[model samples]
Target chain A: MEPDVLLSVRDLRIAFDGVEAVRGVSFDVRPREVLAVVGESGAGKSLTARALLGMVPAGATTGGTIRPDLSDRRGRRIALVPQDALSALSPVHPVGDQLAAAVRSVARVSRKEARARAVAALERVGIPDAARKARAYPHEYSGGMRQRAVIAMATVNEPDIVVADEPTTALDEEHRDQVLRVLGERREAVGAALVLVTHDMDVVREHADRMLVMYAGRLTELGPADEVLARPRAPYTAGLLASLPEHAPRRRRLPALPGTPPAPGALPPGCAFAPRCSLAADACHATEPEPQQVAGRLVACHRWADTPDLLQEAYRASS
Target chain B: MPLLDVRDLVVRYGTVTAVDRVSFSLEAGETLALNGPSGCGKSSTALAVLQLRRPDGGEVHFEGQELTSLTDRELRPLRPRMQPVFQDPYGSLNPRHRIRDAVAEPLRVQGRRPTPGEVAELLDRVGLDPSYGDRRPHELSGGQCQRAGIARALASGPRLLVLDEPVSALDPSVRAGVLNLLADLQDDLGLGYLFICHDRAVVRHFADRVVEMREGRVISGWRRP
Candidate 1:
């Protein structure tokens, strides 16, 4: 029955002191699925990912039941491939030893076995001279190589879920492609769920099966990656999709949603996006918009159902 | 005139050559993007141009002056002419310092006392509210903090802005805002930009010319559409 969702998080909320950073956010990630969490800075996508792994930073505190369905797996519930590769990799430790240590730390594996597995993982990620490169410190490896090293560590344990939080953010396009290719291959080796939290629509479109849109501290929309992108419902989601440079209208003023995103501490009571949302009404300001089924997508907006294909029409009509 | 010119630029950290024979020029009022994989020396090249890091060899001519040979005291006057906006805004600015002080530092460093009126104008240009001036780095969002960094870069009236992975650290959505702001600022002030990044999409969309680097070398020269 639908392979029993690997991680089912509901009504998740994270806060810094009393101010909400992730307010009543929820989503499900299935086995062998890459659910892309797409949002702008301060949209709470990272906080949500951190919540799942129980790895929020010192100042942040969370409220959520991250019930990982790892009964069928042999390793940790989650492994994180952080955005900064150089900082993520220990400068003093050799890349190979670090990766091998990760695999062994997850469970019971002989040091020799883990080292061999580390080499295999490195090879799988397309690192040339895997065995030799393993002994090199972080300073010796290039940016792209270091990123691959991090990915190899995360997947070496064959964890149930991998939280790739902006894993390709620092690398150039070519290196980004290489890292993504490695992650795709690793998914085949270990039937793990991947939650790729990023802001790049191109990345989510290329690699993810499903997508969740976040604004301020709450979820705005959720649906298939392509489907939601093709027909975004929430006004904030529509605005973000339209604002991507590739999707912009030539020689025309961009369809910019005016007003800066609200500070997490000073967010409006009902809808966090009401300030910049053109379609926002009084109802949006009076009460919170719970997730409602609109055109087979879960959208958290009061008037989204009525605006069927409005975003698509707007994008099409722009040019 | 090229706002900034570089030829055979090389920077070394002990025995390791971080940048090797890197050369590209940002034309006056034109954007030139430098794209390459990490450790390709894009950021190092930018820093050396600012003389934040002295190059072991090469020429960095800004506004028709060779910056490489200038001493710290000699370079003081030219420092405001080419300012750097770092990849990480968090690391670039002091955490305890208010946004106003951070943005105003360049002006203050140049021996000009910054008034609230001038700081407000700077904030307005970068799309940050003047109200945010009192807040520290921790109070600002990644995008906002970055815009504040840009304000700092612009405060001293630099003719050429060297943005080293400026928006790469920002979210995709916030990137558009920063880019559009840069474009608008360029149009208004006719300021030249050396947009150093790895994302070809960003380079293609924002820059007038493209330069690619590989292993600290300029593998491809400038190309314009």
Candidate 2:
């Protein structure tokens, strides 16, 4: 791992009842970088984020090393901005009290000092009247306000890395933008690297510096966000981009991925995506492709070079 | 004639006005998407048009018949002309009822006894296996439950379908499939759609025309560019 890498996950595997949900996933997050893990549901994006914090689900066995370089932290240097803020927060307590507890956990601070820090953190996330708002319970806050509070709580101690799982999935367009803005601003303020797990490609395109595409519990593509979006090296990545309705011309049917994601531990033999891939050939069916260095990125595909022009043309026509 | 029409619709709860002077019309085989943020009165507009909630003011017309003026007894006969599919299929569908009975209930409400084959065909039309009719809502996935909901909605042979974020609860891949199914249904049956959604990308693809709402008012309406 590079010296600047804040988090390095290697060969991570999660399984339930002998069924592998996240199989052999690996990635790195550099300091101050926003690494987006994009995939449709059941692709194990959420599980990978959980494994980063050692919070796997019940009945799941995990295998792999998630190395977070947080030597400076006295307690936990990693924080999580969960997808559902309401569930993550204490419903009965005022948000300020909950936030102060988070601060107290990381440092030897007094109750007064922690409360002040909590208000400041809320303000940092763009919540107005932070002191008064902090006194409000989770339900008193709007969806956007609750998410902001969650971001504030997660980053209150200035953690080195923040893992956000589908943070904007519940909000409307306006509120979603607000949450994303606050998340970006807070990350910049704390200089913390972010591991964003989301299925919304538009969010990844807009906020991510690096993109990691997971499919069937494995990494299919990892590269600079722009490069990956411009020309996906993996068929799964290409198919995901094509399926976006934003990429379709008005009145034109979207190019949809024909089938659902394979069930966990029930993936077909050989390439997991070969069954749905349009570029599948004889070689693709016989063996699972390993991640190989191609076009300055890591791509898992045997026939990646053959379909670049086709993807480019399709993207151009739609845009 | 337009399949559904609303003019100067207003809905208020207590001191707060939920929808303010929202107006739109849907022709047969057309889709009009109500796009906006949450708390923008999208649901209120739909409810007022359906007579599920009485509007504070406005006119709701269905094929030249005034729906706003109709009482529960008067509107009972016309209920089959407009049906709703809500966002959460699980919540919208009865948990204890078998899928077959759920689909057949709408037809039964309209004084028609549906055969087993008819219920099976309804399920099949929504892209579900006919055999799924025997199972309950919990036995199915979110997508499957949504398909069953759509199947039930169609059992009434409604000319207008009011879908309130119907595919929002499903995964992205499954969402696309359900969306495609909806489009296919509209095309084949010439059904008009009033699609309420927060997803702009979906609205762009699925709606023939789009109306943007904010602060309980229609801000803009135009043909898709």
Candidate 3:
């Protein structure tokens, strides 16, 4: 393991009923870095994130290895900020009590000390009147406030890493930005790295230090956020970026990616994205591409060299 | 005259006013987006425009006919011309029903059996294969189910569509396909669209005009140059 890397995932594979959902995958989480895992709904990004915490669904089989075995020290060394804030919290208990309980569970602390830490965590996340709000149940808190509370809970233990799975997907634009800002601020305050799993490209562009683009449970691209956004080497990455409304010119029709992602266990031969790739060739159909160094990034596409040129041509033709 | 016009719409749930004197108009083959945050009355305005919920105070005119004053029976005929496609595709559709029967429901509600292949044609029109008609809503993916919902909406032969965050629940790739289908549908059928969406980028791309709302009121509005 690299000394700078906080954790390393090697050939991580997850299966359900003998059907592989996450194929061989590898990545490293550097200290205090934001690593975003992005893909479509059934892309197994969420499954991969959950597997880090040893929280895969029941009856599912997992393979490969995650270094340091952080699962044993869940709250103290690693924590999860789930998608739904309401589900993460107990409706019956006051939000503060939950946070305090979380603190007490991982550490041997007095009730008074734990309660104070809970209030402080709430304050850190910018919940107004933290002490008073602590006594209120989950329902009493508004949606945004509840989300902030969840962030607070995730960071209260001062974990080394936080895995947030589409934390702001349910929120509208204003609330979404606010929640991300709070999450970012809290993670910075705790000096914890974040593994953000989201499908929103804009969020990835704005918040991630590095991005892992997934396609049909396989890595298609992995690189620094700015470089990947600026010059994508993978055809799948190019297509996904081109289809975004914000990135495209305001037109009647967007240049959408041609087809839906194939379901797990029903993947196509060779590369999973070849069927939808405009630049796909016979070699792409015959053999799957392995991640190779290309322009400071790792791209799993045989036609990585020609992706940019083809992308420009496609854009010109569309415009 | 515009295809649809709403004037001084007001909806109150007990002490809370959801839609306060909100007004907008739409034209045939044009898209007017209602853009705002959640709880800002965007959906309430849509419900009022569709007459799905009778506004406490307002005048909704469709094809120059006032809809608020019409009884449920009186509005039945006009309802077919203006259809709603909700955000949740799976929830809007009956899980137990096949896609074919769901699409045929509008005609059946009017006491007319759909002509042979009409349901299949509707499904195909939305870019879904006609064979999808044999499957239920749960048997399809989110994007596929949403397409089925759109097919059902088209079965009524609507001149106006109230699309309330139709693509928000879908993935980006799937959303783009659905949005393109909507644009093509409008071009081919001259359908008027009252689009309600919170995504500004999508609203900018899809709508001809935009009505920005906040705190139950129309804060501002603009049109594409």
Candidate maximizing TM-score? 3
Give a tens-digit lDDT track for model 1, residues A181-231: 777765676667788998777788888889999888888999999888887
Q: Alpha-carbon error at A25 in model 1, in Å?
A: 3.3
DockQ result, candidate 3: 0.70
In model 3, the runs with Cα more than 4 Å from the true position are A1-3, A309-319
Residue-wise lDDT of candidate 2 within A93-186, one digit each (tens)? Answer: 9999998998888789999999999999899887999999999999999887888888888878887778899888877766677667766775
Query: What tens-digit string does per-residue lDDT give for candidate 2 at B124-166?
Result: 8998889999899998888889999999999988999999999
Highest-scoring model, lDDT: 3
How does model 2 score by TM-score?
0.93
State which candidate, 2 or 3, has the greater TM-score. Answer: 3
Candidate 3 docking classification: medium
What is the i-RMS of every prediction? 2.8, 1.7, 1.4
lDDT of 3 by residue, A135-238 (tens): 99999987878888998999898888889999877677776776677667745675568999998877887899999999888888999998887778898888
Candidate 1 Cα RMSD (Å)? 3.5
iRMSD computed for candidate 1: 2.8
TM-score of chain B of each: 0.96, 0.98, 0.98
The ten-residue window of minimal lDDT in model 3 chain A covers A309-318
Predicted complex 2: DockQ: 0.60
Error of model 1, residue B52, in angstroms: 2.9
